[model samples]
Target: MKLSDFELDVLQLFWQHGDCSAKQIHEWVCETKPSAYTTVKTIVDRLEDKGAIKRVGKDGRAFVFQTQISKDDLTPSILPSFVKRFFAGNASSLITHLIDDEKLSDDELEYLENYLAKKKKSKS
Candidate 1:
C-alpha cells in the first residue's frame, strides 16, 4: 500500500513505539514540530485506510492503533521508486554512491562483507 510522506512519518512512530493512541502520536510528533492533533489524526486515518495500520484498542476517548504492515514491507514497496528516481534504475551506481559518499564504520563494512559472503555461498 502506498503511503503519503506524512503517513510514512506517522507510521514510523507507530513502528518505533508500538501500539499507541492518536493523542499519544500527536504528542510525540509535536515534540519534534508543531502540528495540530487533528492533522496528525488525519494522517493516522489515512494510514488505516491504506491498511498500514488499524484500531486495536482505545484509551479513554481516543482510539489506540497498531501497525498492520511492517518496515520491511514499506522498504520493498518504496525501493523501486527510489532506485528509479535517484539512481535511474542502476543498482550498481547506487551501491557505488553509497560506498563512496555514505560514511560506513568498520563494523558496518565488515557486516556487509559477511552478508555478501553468505549470499555467495548460498548461490554456489
Candidate 2:
C-alpha cells in the first residue's frame, strides 16, 4: 500500500511500540518535530483506513491501535520502488552507496560480509 511519509512514520511507531493510543503517538512525534494532535489523529485514521493499522482496544477516551502489517512484509514492497527512484533500480548501487558513505561499525561490516557470503553460497 502506498503511504505518505507521515503515515509511514505513524505506522512505524505502532510496529515499534506494539500498541499505542493517538495521544501517545502525537507526543512521540512531537519529540522530533512539532505536530498538532489532530494531525496525528488524522494520520492514524488514514492508516486504519489503509489497513496498515487496526483498533485493538482503548486507553481512557483514546482508541488504541496496533500494526496490521509487519515491517518485513512492508519493506520488500517499498525497497524496489525506493531503489528504482534513487539508484536507477540498481540494488548494488544502493548497497555500494551505503557501504561507502555511511558510518558502519566493524561489527556491522562483519555482519554484512557474513550475510553476503551466505547469500552467495546459497546461490551456488
Candidate 3:
C-alpha cells in the first residue's frame, strides 16, 4: 500500500513504540517539529483508513493504535519503485552510491561484505 511521508512517519512510531495513543504520538512528533495534535490525529486516522495501523485498545479517552504492517512488509514494496525512480532501476548503482558516498563504519562495511559473500555462496 502507498503511504504519504507523514503516514509513514506515524506508522514508524507504531512500529518502534509498539502501542501508543494519539496524544503520545503527537508529543513524540512535536519533539522534532512543531505540529498541532489534530494534525497528528488526522494522520493517524488516515493510517487506519489505509490499514497500516489498527485501533488495539483504549487508554482513558484516547484510542491506542498498533501497526498492522511491519517494516519488512512495507520496504520490499517501496524499495523497487524508489530505486527505479532515483537510480533508474539499477540496484547496483544504488548500493555503490551508499557504499562509496555514505559514511559507513568499519563494522557496517564488514557486515555488508559478509552479507554479500553469503549471498554469492547461496547463488552458487
Compute the lDDT for candidate 3: 0.92
The TM-score between candidate 2 and the true structure equals 0.89
lDDT of each: 0.90, 0.91, 0.92
lDDT of 2 by residue, 22-93 (tens): 999999999988999999999999999999888989888889898889988889889999999999999999
> Model 3: residues >4 Å from true position, as ranges?
none
Model 3 residue 47 CA deviation in Å: 1.0
In the range 37-91, model 1's lDDT, one tens digit per residue, is 9999899988888888999988888899999988887898888888888999988
Q: What count of clashes does model 2 give?
A: 0
Clashing pairs in 3: none
RMSD of each candidate? 1.9, 1.5, 1.7
Q: Where in model 2 is the C-alpha error above 4 Å?
A: none
1-124: candidate 3 lDDT, tens digit per residue: 9988788888888888899999999999998889999999999999989888889999999999988899999999889998999999999999999889989999998999999999999999
Candidate 3 TM-score over all chains jointly: 0.87
**TM-score of every model?**
0.85, 0.89, 0.87
lDDT of 3 at 28: 91
Q: Please report how far candidate 2 places residue 1 from its true position, in Å.
A: 1.3
Select the stronger candidate by lDDT from 1 and 2. Answer: 2
Give me the candidate number with maximum TM-score: 2
